[model samples]
Target: MIVFDLECRRGQHRFEGWFRSSEDFARQEELGLLTCPNCGSADIGKALMAPHVGRKGNQMPVHAPSVPPPAAAPAPTTLPAPAPAAVAAPAVSSTPLPPEAMALMHKLARMQAEALKSSRFVGSSFADDARAMHYGEREAETIHGQTTIEEARELLDEGIAVAPLPFPVVPPEQAN
Candidate 1:
C-alpha cells in the first residue's frame, strides 16, 4: 500500500489518500473516482511529495562522509531539527529551518496543548469511548488518548468522527 499527499485544486485542502499503487492512484484520478475527502470536490491532484523510493531487498543505504567536501560552504550556526517520524533519518548534511520556523512549531504545540486541556484521557479506552459516543450509548465529550491506527481507521469506516493529533501528546499523568 502507498499513501499520497493529495490536494483539492478548488479548495486547496490537503489530505492523505491510500492506494494499492501509483497506477491505482492514476486510474482513480482518471476515472474521477478520486475526490477531496474534505470538500467532496472531484478536482484533485497529487501534491509535491518528498521522494520515498523503495530500496531493493539487498541494497544498503549510503551514508555521507563526516568530513566536509572541498567545495562545501562554511557550516551554519544552527542545527537541523530532528526529522519527522514519517521519514528515514538523514545520513548527510541537513539544512536547518530558521528561528522563525522553530518558534512557529513551538507556538503550534502550545496551541494544541491548550485546545486539549479539557479533554479526558481515555488511554486504551479511546476506541471504546469514541464508539460509545458515536452510537449514542453515552454522552459525547472531549477525549484524547492512544489507539492503534487500525482502530482509528475502523472508527472512520464506521462513520465515527475521530482525529489523530498532529503532534504526539503526553498523557496527563506523564505531564504531571
Candidate 2:
C-alpha cells in the first residue's frame, strides 16, 4: 500500500490516504471518491511532500557546502550530475515514550485524578449544573461532566468559568 499526504482544498485539512498504488489514488480522485476525512470535502489534492530514499550501508554521506559558490568564480571544467533533493525524516526509533516525557505524563495524570476526586460527576447535566453554580442557585463547588461542544461554548460565552478536563473520567454509575 502507498500512503499519500492528501489535503482538502475547502478546509485545508491535511490527512493521509492509503491506496493500492499511485495509479489507484489518481483513479479514485478522478472518480470523485477522494475526500477529506475532517470536513468530508471532495476537493482533495496531494499535499507537498519531501523525497524519501534509503541509503546503502557502504555509501558515504554528502556534506553540504559551507558557503555558496561565488557568482564570479570560474565554472568547473567538468560538472558532476545533479544530486537529488533532501532525504526523508529519520524513522521512528522507539515505541515507548522517553523517560522525561513519560514522567511528565504521569505527573499530569496524577494531577487530573486528584482534581477529579473533589469534582462531582453530573454526567450530561454539566452545562446546567455549571450555570446553576454560577448563578448561586447551587453552592459553588468543583464539578466535571460531559457536555456537547455547543453547550460548552455557551457556558464560556455566558461568563461561566467552565473548562474541559484533560482526561475523561468514569461516571460513578459506570464505575465499580
Per-candidate clash tally: 0, 0
Task: Tell me model 1's lDDT, rounded to 2 decimals.
Answer: 0.81
lDDT of 2 by residue, 1-176 (tens): 77767778998877777778899888888988876666777898888977557799999999998987889997789986542211122346669989998899889899999888888888999999999989999898898899999999999999987777776788899898
Model 1 lDDT at residue 8: 83
The C-alpha stretches of model 2 lying farther than 4 A from their native spots are 1-94
| Number of the predicted model whose lDDT against the real structure is largest | 1
Report the error of model 2 at residue 141, Å: 1.2
Weakest 10 consecutive residues of candidate 2 by summed lDDT: 82-91
| CA error at residue 4 for candidate 2, angstroms | 13
